[model samples]
Every structure is written in structure tokens, then in C-alpha cells.
Target chain A: MEFYPKLKASIEEIFATMIFLDLTAAEPLAAGTEDLGCHVSAMIGLSGDFNALLGIHCPAKVGLAIGSAMLGMELEEIDDDTKDALGEISNMLAGGIKESFAGENVNLLLALPTTISGKSYKINTPSGSQRVIFPCEIEAGRFYIDFKYSPR
Target chain B: MGKTVLIVDDSNTMRKIVSRALRQAGIDFSEILEASDGQEALDVLAKNKVDIVLSDINMPNMTGLEFLKAKAENAAIKDIPVVMISTETGADIIDQAKALGAKGAVKKPFTPDLINETLGPLL
Candidate 1:
């Protein structure tokens, strides 16, 4: 859980400073998959000292809010604008995690982020990777971060 | 005529943000060109007279570093100032960018002032 705390902090910092939103990690319901009915997702593949997958999942409403905040405009749907916002945030998360590993002597390579928006889809963790999901509450709606990692 | 800028990033959102920051920095760009990756940037560079390039390090197809190397090797676009903008805060990455002939490196989630301060000298 060492990375979890840092992950939480990173998420909060990014949301607060970059998007001007505040995030509070939801308890119990955090990481729950029940309400992923309509959502937006962005993921980046990490390689090098360790292989991992890091991603962000947000509901449509939350995605809109994030997109609007990022672009200084109002977004009504999960369109290209919304996907781009999530992708940038995902990239930031990758960088934040990389910064945390500065003294670890491990070099991490982050692939370009992949984004999708829809309903009734599920994400699976790769074999031998530990998946940790954190559900978070934002002013507009809820979102989550999924970090899956395993030594290569 | 104002300066022309080339913004390169795989994420459309990032390109927009950087463009907005540049505008906010009080840089009056005559034309702002965009590219999804380094290869696309090269395509744009071949025909356009861009004053500077702001690129991201990690991208699909051709990366920013690869593009920078290409720019350095070619005399035509070698002198165009390149400023790297990315989530990569690592020293090695920034150092490598500088070594590859980047004029400056701007960390992601950057502020308009930071962008201006870092890229101002190069311009």
C-alpha cells in the first residue's frame, strides 16, 4: 500500500492544481464496479524496471466536469475533448508515479495513453500483476484510479 | 508578422492546453501548427516555416526524442528551437532532451507563466 498513498496524493494534487477540483477517496465503495454503467477510461502501459498498467476511470458526468475544467469550457458529452482530458490526466499520473521512483534505480517507460468511453465494459488485470483500485469522490461526481503492477 | 509555433503531442487535449498557455503567455503567434507525433511534426516542418516547436517526449509512432534527433541531424530544421513539454520530470529525460539539442524542457501541468519563463529566452 506504499504506492497507494502516493497514488492518492498524486491524484489529489493533479485534480486540485491542474483541474481546480478536490478529490476525496470514497470508503468501501471506492473501486466498486457496480456503477460503471456509463464511463470514460484512459490507460497507459508502463515498462522498464517494472511492468505496470495505470489508468483512470470516470463517469460521464465527471468526465465532462474534468474536460470542462481542463479546457475552460463546458463539455456536454464524452467526446474527443473528454477523452483528451482523461488522457492528459493519465499521462500526469504516469509522470507522478515515475517521479516517486526517482531513487529506486528503476527506469520506467510510459506508452501513449489509450482512451475509451462507453457503458457495460470491464477491465481485466494482466496475469501476475497486482491490481489496486481506488474510488474517489470529486465535487462533480466520482472517479477511480487502477494501478496494476508486477516485476518484469 | 508574429512568430509561428508548432505544437506536437499525441493527446489533443495537451496540444490545446499548450496552445492556450502560449497565447496566454502573450506570444502573438501568426500561425500555430499541430502534430499528433514527431513524424507528423516533420511533415509539417517540411513545408512550413515554424519559429519553434513544443513537443512531448512519449508518443505513438515517432517520439519527441526521436524527432529531436532527426531535427538535429538535418540542417534544414536543426536550428529551429525545440522545447519539450511532458509529464516526464526525470532528470535523465530532460538532460537527454537537452543533449539532443532541445532549447528547454517544460514539465506537464505547466502554468502559463512557467511556459513563458522557460521558453522566453529561446524565442
Candidate 2:
């Protein structure tokens, strides 16, 4: 299935609606070890017929921008609620897609979102075992959404 | 020139923003009702003659999509325009909503002007 187009549309929708921002996709980076810096990563595990991971990565600035959009809060510094909002957004996006594929082969694992610093971490999935990432820039902050799937 | 609009969502923060924006859009009505979820919305829709519905797509017991679907199945409820509000931007989701017979859709973290612009003509 034309997955890239689907992913592109989904990511763009999330950004456009969530924070009232426009998102254009950047090049897919070859796996690199750059410190991803201060960002929020939302991970949703796809189980059942589709064994994979859908992850959203955003810098502190993007996270704060989202928070600003929802809570009307101006966040200069990241806080627990800020991180929670990012995680909720990923869950919502994932849930939206899951609803689309309802009764299909895929199942969702209700994973809690974790906040972390640095860009050194990696997603260990059944698929090729690297970040197949797409760069996204919003409100002066740059981020990425990475996807990978694994076999049972 | 006037019609009732029901705004449904769980968050007070979001509800306030939506109400303010609706008012800003010049959507003055004799009645404006608010519901927190599908079941709550059902209650409001039971007797009230609402012309338009603005709902958050994601909520605890019932979601906007589900509400839309259920409303579609009911003859009395189907005609009322349901506009989904959320942070979700999936194309498939939008298509699904349109297919389910949504009159319109708006994304979250809304600006008064944007909300008014998207909803005004549609309503």
C-alpha cells in the first residue's frame, strides 16, 4: 500500500489541526546518531497483524507550541503536563488511524508515553531496526516522525 | 439567520475556546448547548432542536466519529450538521468523517478567526 502518502497525510493533519501550524516533510534521513536534542517522542506499538511502531518526535519548542495551542499555556520550560500533552497527541493520532482500520488485522498496545532528553535513543522494532524518519519543521522548531514494523 | 449549535467536548479549556469562537463567528442563537461526550450529547439532542453540532473527535466514553455514526443511523439525528473538532489531521479520518455524513470539520487549538471562518459559511 502507498504507505508514505498515507503517513504524510496523517502527520500533516496532526500538525495542522493540533497547533494550527503547517508541516512540510523533509528528506528521510539515513540512520544517524545526532543528539535529537530536547524533544518529545510519542510511541505507539502496533501489534496483531501489523507488528510495527509509529513514533512522533518533536523538540521542546514544538512540544511547547502544541501545549500553547491546547491549554493556552505559554511554556518556556518543559513540564510534566507538557510531556503528557505530547503523548496524548500521539495516542490520539494513533487512535484515529486505528479507528480507520477497525476490525482489520492490526491491534494497538496501550503504551504510556515517556519523556526523554537527547537524540541518542533508538526505536527497537521488528522492522529493519532503525529510524526511518521524516523531518518536520514547525514554528521555528524542527522535528521528525519515524515508522518501523516488525514480524511476529 | 439563527440556529442552535451544540458544542460537545470533555475539556473546559477547549469548550471555552470553542464557545468564544462561535460567538465571535456571529453565531448568535436563542440557545447554545454543551455536552461532554456522546451519551451526554444524546441527552441534549433528545429534546432540543439543534441545527449544528461541533464536537471534539476524541473523548472518553464516546468519540465524535462514533457519535456521528450513531447519529447517522438515526433518522431524526442524521440531518443535524455535525462538525468534528480535534487535533487529529489524518486524511483517512477526514474522509471517513465525510463519508459518515459530517457537514464539516475543524481542527483543534483553534483560533477565533479560523474557527469562525471554517464554521460560519458551513453552518
Q: Which runs of model 2 end up more than 4 angstroms from their true locations? A: A1-5, A13-24, A32-34, A45-49, A69-73, A76-127, B1-4, B10-34, B43-51, B56-58, B65-123
Worst 10 residues of 1 chain A by lDDT: A27-36
Alpha-carbon DockQ of candidate 2: 0.15
lDDT of each: 0.84, 0.68
Docking model 1 quality class = medium
Candidate 1, residues A1-152, lDDT tens digits: the string is 25687677777777766677777975423333454544789999888888898988888888899899888889998899899899889889888888778657667878878899777556554444477777888888778788888878
Q: Per-prediction TM-score, please?
A: 0.88, 0.58
Predicted structure with the largest lDDT when compared to the true one: 1
Q: Interface root-mean-square deviation for each candidate?
A: 1.4, 5.6
Chain A TM-scores, per candidate, are: 0.86, 0.74
Write one digit per residue (lDDT tens) for candidate 2, span B10-82: 6654665577677766766667789989878987998899988888776778877888888888898888888
Instruction: Compute the lDDT of residue A9 as modeled in candidate 1.
Output: 74
